[model samples]
Target: MLALRDGQLYVLAPDGWTRLGGPAPASSTPLNREDAEDWCEREGWDLHLLDQVPQLTA
Candidate 1:
């Protein structure tokens, strides 16, 4: 689960990774894993092609 540093709220998941959100670093790099189709559908994320990578852009 992901939590705000000030403890305002959080995201809970039975099985998934959580990130501390912020502007990504200056370096050009990928983040997060490529989830399965079923997993994306279950999570309400729309996977699309972004810069040749399958991106969960929801």
Candidate 2:
């Protein structure tokens, strides 16, 4: 999962959440993983893995 908080973008890594880079522009919009990737690509921002968390088995 990914999140944008306080103008910065973070991704959920194996260890924990990690910041992708510097703060996003004020005009940036909230987006899901796929959309975020596309947005980053079009905007020339670095791409980060957008892996979905695996489901836990009981």
Candidate 3:
């Protein structure tokens, strides 16, 4: 699954979310990994991703 955490794009993986690069409508480079499970208890991963969907352009 795809998501955004702190303005960067992320893709879900076996271990955690890996940064796919962006703040979108911007640039892309240097992907990284951030442990996103912490968010599962807070606002929920689905909510987080939903909030950012409008920020993306087709």
Candidate 4:
């Protein structure tokens, strides 16, 4: 599922954080980055850039 608060978007899953589909809302919908981050943090999750991960090749 998806959730919006302040101006950010969040993907809810049974496990840890899912993914960020878009930036904070600006027009029709409502989203909050800070709130989302806070929620994730509260849930022991972190928002990180995939690029930060080491590249893998097979």
For each candidate, give its TM-score against the true structure. Answer: 0.24, 0.36, 0.35, 0.34
Each model's lDDT:
0.38, 0.61, 0.49, 0.48
lDDT of 2 by residue, 1-58 (tens): 4566555577656565677776655775667777878865786655654443333345
Q: If the candidates were sorted by their TM-score against the true structure, best first, what order would they fall in?
A: 2, 3, 4, 1
Winner on TM-score between 2 and 3 is: 2
List residue ranges in candidate 3 displaced over 4 A: 22-58
RMSD of each: 11.3, 8.0, 10.8, 8.5
Where does the lowest 10-residue lDDT sum fall in candidate 2? 49-58
Model 4 pairs in collision: 5-31, 5-32, 6-31, 7-24, 7-25, 7-31, 7-32, 8-31, 8-32
Off-target runs (Cα >4 Å) in candidate 1 are 1-35, 49-58
Backbone clash pairs for candidate 3 read none
lDDT of 1 at 13: 45
Model 2 misplaced regions, further than 4 Å: 22-58
Best by TM-score: 2
Model 1, 1-58: lDDT tens digits are 2323243323334433344356434563433444444445676745332112322444
**lDDT of model 2, residue 2:** 56
